[model samples]
Target: MANKPSPSPTWDEYVSELGRNLQRARISSGLSQEQVAYRSHLSRYTYQKLESGIARPGAPANPTLRTLVTVARILAVEVSQILPAAAPDLPEP
Candidate 1:
């Protein structure tokens, strides 16, 4: 029999966990969302959206690498620390 492919993860799940990671990192760094946004050169509103893991009212977030890098830098965390473990559906390089 041909091998079956597994269901891919909903990116929302990964994004939600990433948001939690960012929140925890920010809390640990003792910075408010506004502070991190300012330091990262992002608008407070944008940062809030990032932290909520939502791009819009009902859409899942898909942040830029630049945004992730700056936020991680401000939080004193490696980007890996904030990223979820898997992207099984992602295309192999």
Candidate 2:
């Protein structure tokens, strides 16, 4: 039999978790979306979309790695802190 791919969360789920993590980190850092966005050299709307995980028509935004790095720097957090943790692998018997 062919090897099967591991199951993972849907794209929407990953986006939502990333957004939530960014929001929490921003809140903890006592910064508003506008403040962070400006500092990160991004538009407020873009940052808002990233943090809300809704770009258009209820779809998730596709954020770039550069954007994430910028946001993390502005928020004084590591990039890893803004990303969601991966699910642990299952153990074999």
Candidate 3:
């Protein structure tokens, strides 16, 4: 039998991508996790959780717009760089 193609990425996948971008940016800047968190005005533990790809245990990391912009500023990366190219579909508010 032929293998089936995977379905579209879920919200969790998007969150994972964001985490990856954050890690890459931090590495490129030669900044420690603690440094990034502190500069971003986030707690080290909370930053660790985001870098680990979860907002909480068994949950996706859906950061608020303020948080995203703040982290991007600290990392010197564009917000678009930290966001997945494609995101899960959501109804218009």
Candidate 4:
């Protein structure tokens, strides 16, 4: 049988988790959102949305890799540190 794709969290779940991770990292680093935003060269509103996982109209923030990288650098963490762990390749039968 062909290999099936791995199960993963829903988009909302993933985005929410990412936001939580970012928030935790920021707090642990003793940096406020505004400070991180300034250091990352991103608008405060954009960084808020990213950390909250909600865009205008109640949609997920869905930040780009570049944004994540920039924020990670400002927070002094590797990108993987903010990413969710890999899901299992397949669900059990």
TM for every model, in the order presented, reads: 0.84, 0.81, 0.84, 0.81
Candidate 1: tens digits of C-alpha lDDT, residues 1-93: 998865766778778888899999999999999999999998999899888999898898899999999899999999999997766355567
Give candidate 4's total backbone clashes: 0
Give the TM-score comparing model 1 with the true structure, all chains together. 0.84
- 51-80 per-residue lDDT for model 2 (tens digits): 888788778777999999989998899999
lDDT of 3 by residue, 32-71 (tens): 9999889888899899888878988889887889988998
Candidate 1 error regions (>4 Å): 1-8, 88-93
Clashes of each: 0, 0, 0, 0
Screening candidate 3 with a backbone cut-off below 3 angstroms (N, C-alpha, C), the clashing residue pairs are none
Off by over 4 Å in 4: 1-7, 86-93
Q: How does candidate 1 score on lDDT?
A: 0.88
lDDT of 4 by residue, 6-89 (tens): 778767778888889999999999999999999999999999998888887668777889999989998999999998775323
In angstroms, how far off is 7's CA in candidate 4?
5.4
Q: Give candidate 3's TM-score.
A: 0.84
Model 2: residue 67 alpha-carbon error in angstroms: 0.4
What's the lDDT for all of these models? 0.88, 0.86, 0.85, 0.86
